[model samples]
Target: MEATELNIRISFGRKHALALLSAFFLCWHPGFIGSETLQLTTFYPAPYGGYVSLLTTGGTNTVPANTILARNAGRVGVGTGTPDSKVDIRIPVGLGANGVQITDDNANPDTRSYATLGVTRAASGNNLAYIGLTKQGTYPWAIGVAGSNDLIMGASSAGNRTIPSPMFSIDTGGQIAMGGGAEAGRRLRVVGDLRVTGDIYVNGRIQGLCQRIGYSITGVTSCPWNHNVIGFLGDGVARVSGFLPASATTSGVGRFIVLGEDWGGTMICCRF
Candidate 1:
């Protein structure tokens, strides 16, 4: 008779009681209890209605549909193409302070078309060239051309004043010749220290060699010892010509006709 105290009834639907009350508050509040403050809004739909916009607050990640996140401050615009389709920005690792920096606009001047092969800069101040290999300054009149025949080999530095001309020069058909043979075999071959001051015109031969003590004759005649042009008291005096194998008939000594040596004999110091 007391069995009528038993009465039970329960029913829930609206999406199964909101998924069974979200699985009983995710198994009794497992952790992270709502709103550590996060709000993000970004939208780009019809005709890009809102060109671009992004807002984030106390983020844990959001706004990634065409991302544009600006939280504190910003301004960015770079478009001057070509450098391999430019658009590379990366700086974050002790955030930059000198690694690459180039800011130029000295009244705007920069023009380069190609042939700037290795290292070049002539940002408009007149630089026309076919060839220009520079080291220092001042090239008032510089012209160096060697397409086929023009050989300058070795040390060359100008200015500080040192001009010791004549290393080479020969012009034949128009007559301005120099001689050595075979048209011009020895144009110039100077070994070292050679100082000649004025007046030296040798159209053919001015050879030298002499060491006679025992009727020495190596080739190219005339020398018979009478030698006496002893004039030397300083200021410059050495013009002696008379001695050794020049037809030794000795009549008043003094003979030297050595013209490329072939030795014919004479050595008598006192007869002329």
Candidate 2:
């Protein structure tokens, strides 16, 4: 039942006023009983327009508990009343709370679940978005999308650092750059010369079995310019006419010669 206020200026005794107020209450609630309860506070407006501090209870006739609160500056809070942001929420008491989750229960397979952050413009060397991980006493690490559209992962040099230097990055074209400040234009580009610990394979076949470092010479005593005789062989009856020196005296010099019978053999010449 709705209670109506009666503007009565009674020039009577306090007992008379109490009797008249009880009669007025009985008038609004016609079916009132001795054991029944009628909370009369609901029929009146709140004292203040908003709350100045956190509200723990709503008195005897109101709610027993409250989980939502609005600040005087129009900030709403959940699980707390002293909000800092526009909509602040904090876990009051929990051991392992996951905080919040944005979910969609639609039965469509191709439905996109989105949690988007949109920024109109970003400063140079800044991240458009980033996820950071930190330990108790270690430098924080982060992986982020740079302002230039490169995906970068870096560790903070200091504890209070905001922007992170890129250790390596993948550009918008799917090319990855290694080392600091390096750019890649090929499919796999490295900043330094490659060193292989194992055998290299090309087109699924092993490479670098043997390399042709020198040319074969048949029946030649002296090699060409910048070439030296590394190995020489003769026929059964032929021997070297002179002593074969390990070092050549002159450029394009050879110590091999035919001594006894007509003899000719190949000479392996190598150039450094």
lDDT of 1 at 9: 81
Candidate 2, backbone clash total = 0
Q: lDDT of all predictions, in order shown?
A: 0.30, 0.50
* lDDT over C-alpha atoms for residue 172 of model 1: 38
Tens digit of lDDT per residue, candidate 1, span 54-144? 3322323232212223322232212111112223222223311211223222221122222111111111111111122223232212111
TM-score for each candidate, following the candidate numbering: 0.17, 0.31
- Candidate 2 clashing pairs? none
Candidate 2 ranges with C-alpha deviation above 4 Å: 1-126, 157-163, 181-184, 192-198, 203-272
- Report backbone clashes per prediction: 19, 0
Each prediction's RMSD to truth: 22.2, 18.9
- Write model 2 residue lDDT over 144-189, tens digit each, in one string: 6776778777764222223456767788888887654436556445
Q: What is the lDDT of candidate 2?
A: 0.50
